[model samples]
Target chain A: MTEEHDHSGNPPQPDEDRLAATEFEILERALRELLIEKGVFTADDIRIAVEAMDRKDPANGSKVVAHAWVDDAYRARLLDDSKAAIEELGIDVGPAPNLVVLENTATLQHVVVCTLCSCYPRTLLGMPPSWYKSREYRGRVVVEPRAVLREFGTELADDVEIKVVDSTADMRYLVLPARPDGTDGLSEAELADLVTRDSLIGVTQPNAPSGG
Target chain B: MSDQEVAPAFTAGQHVQVKTGDPPGHIRTPTFLRGKSGVIEQLHGVYRNPEDLAFGGQGFPKMPLYLVRFSQTEVWDNYDGSPKDSVLADIYQHWLEPGAE
Candidate 1:
């Protein structure tokens, strides 16, 4: 008879109130307020920064991948100096950590993980997914990469050597997944559409063109 | 040591082993990698030491970092993957010592 039972044949809804903030969250909020009070940065500045970070996604990485796929010279340049090559696409990575692009070949497959912390290519691929930050992933990916990859529906052949690169220091890694076959006729934009965030992370390959 | 004064002791393709110790404080080295032998894949340039930077100290005497490669079987007791599989990590120069091939 009350609000709980007034759902008109629908099941009971769970409470939707927000949970309490953690210690780190409290500290961050306090620090932000203190900084704002001291005129270090205005609230608008913080909002703009957060918005810019949120606006970034896998598309930025996909553009780079697509460009490299069509241009052999660009691919070579990306492998040699990722920062400068990426900048040519007008994607500014800023004064970020050193970006290393790992090329996946027929015999070698590369996967990236941050065993110490979630040091990711945020400027290129945006914030990492939740699983990339989980303790399970951080611990297992290095030791049991094949099994971990299998869980993500990525099955590598026994002949293929798996290379797990742990982002333990200042350098960040981006996996250059092998371009799927049978799509040589596709345009760069269409190829970009096939690139997923998981592919960039080396957990999965880019989805192949449908019916191609 | 100043950045200019520090020279990379190890070079590409050279075999080396990570120094084994549980030194206290903010260390960038992972515990599992300690004592494991690997080859210096490449010199990844010099950077300010994160250990000192973490504690607000100037990360002076920037250290040369290298990409070290280790076979999966060598790193783990019973690595389930293929013997050819390997793990690579960006390790600082200070944590490495020359090792047998």
Candidate 2:
């Protein structure tokens, strides 16, 4: 994860947001209680679902990118059929809301944003960064992507094209950033180490290995 | 839901126009891209309509979703990025119609 991915650095949610969060929590609890009482689903099942979400993080996406960087076959599969490719690596991305992988090539760059709302691939990348859900990002990224990338300290050359993918509904996109130069000798683990959560989101490119 | 009933109406590389007119209730199509023309980059298979899913409806009659690509120049008149640059968005079949070349 990069500096931008550090949720610890994020400012505390505002009073209204906090209140909304509490309201949602209470509603969720009430619904769960009702469901349980109606014999729809057990509390234990809800707990397991919560735990599964907790277990997911950027590492899942990093591993997938690292594998693609090292293995052409896997990369082909990923681009051709992302859900199946990811599942081949033993990560089931649930049944609904399909997942799509976008590759960043030398001539093209990919960025992900949800303009309508904060619809993200939570199962694969854990919770999105606070900034990701902010109205500023959602509103601007689609209209002024280069400027937004500049704000994130990413400056691209004029020749490199940028493609902003708006995760509007059922589809979730993960950016497969171009492998940095001078990483030819790096192992898959080492390559994954260089890939950051921000890179997966396409805010910035992967950090090149130091002193390689 | 399996896509056995309806064959996908569009294919990758085919042109499409995002339909205009707002339907009340939860919608996945963003206003910015509505009535815009773009090319279908990929077919995302069949899935239950999320608009129906949002409201507790069964989200029935699976529809083919697509990754649509529109040039920055096409979507916005004053887009700051390179004209070659484009954007991709996931849109449902209902929101798209065949586009003029």
Candidate 3:
């Protein structure tokens, strides 16, 4: 006879099948097909765009951060004209919204959110994480940023000022996290490894240099 | 409409308050910021008004957008964070008026 394991601790879970497509998904499919039919663009064009977007990741932003940490002039240029500085690294920002780099100082911190919608620097950091686009994050981060940062395991001294930037229009912000302590000897490539996606978002600081 | 014909109504370091209203259609101004006071942080040049563009109209006479900085204490009554904490948002010219510093 087949043996049935005890089910006390483990409840029956739902099947792992894909759910039906959402209304928005259906609408998007319909719109895509209509646009292709009208010769706006071919299916191949859409596929290529999607693939390109998928390839963009936080490493691009990490490289920018690492370079800024090592070079004072690049940091200045990044703060003054972020788009040009970013492009100087051979990174294409495309026709995205103007990029603004907010420098985190000893006495101040910066965090970013999109209260209106999910506006992000996709070309530099890939698509935003699911939480970045969630209603709770979009709503709470602006009002209680410190608390939100705490939830992300980031704690700041009371004296440090927190600046929350709400991307409401044609501008996207990238946080330039302060370089971690005792990494003066690290190379630019090593520094880039320390930068994290959360650091770029200002939710947390960069990871400490390994073994130091 | 041309942006060249009209200059921006506000400039950096100017104090302004967001216009409060519940007008219909594609408004980018956050409701929490309405009637709140802030200082202009930077001018982001002119752009087509999203409100107009939402309905397929040419967002002409592009409006000047500025990054407005608002204190968290002033924005929220029970702001538990430090008084030094502040929030910044990109605001359009049409949604602002002179405010007391």
What residue pairs clash in candidate 2, if any at all?
none
DockQ comparisons of all candidates to the true complex: 0.90, 0.82, 0.90
lDDT of 1: 0.92
Give the range of the ten consecutive residues with the poorest summed lDDT in model 2 chain B.
Answer: B1-10
> Any runs in candidate 3 off by more than 4 Å, and if so which?
A1-23, B1-6
* Per-residue lDDT of candidate 1, residues A1-212 (tens digit): 46655667888755554567789988999999999999999999989998888888889999999999999999999999999999999998978899999998878899999999899999888899999999999999998999999999999999999999999999999998889998899999999999999998898999989993
Q: What is the lDDT of candidate 3?
A: 0.92
Show the lowest summed lDDT stretch of 10 residues, model 3 chain A: A11-20
Per-residue lDDT for B41-98 in model 3, tens only?
9898888888988999888768889999999999999999899999999998999999
| Model 1 stretches astray by more than 4 angstroms | A1-20, B1-5
Q: Rate the local accuracy (lDDT) of all candidates.
A: 0.92, 0.89, 0.92
Fnat values, one per model, are 0.94, 0.88, 0.94
How many angstroms is residue A93 displaced in model 3 relative to the true structure, after the best TM-score fit?
0.9
Error of 2 at A34 (Å): 2.0
For model 3, name the residue pairs that clash: none
TM-score per prediction, in order, is 0.93, 0.87, 0.92
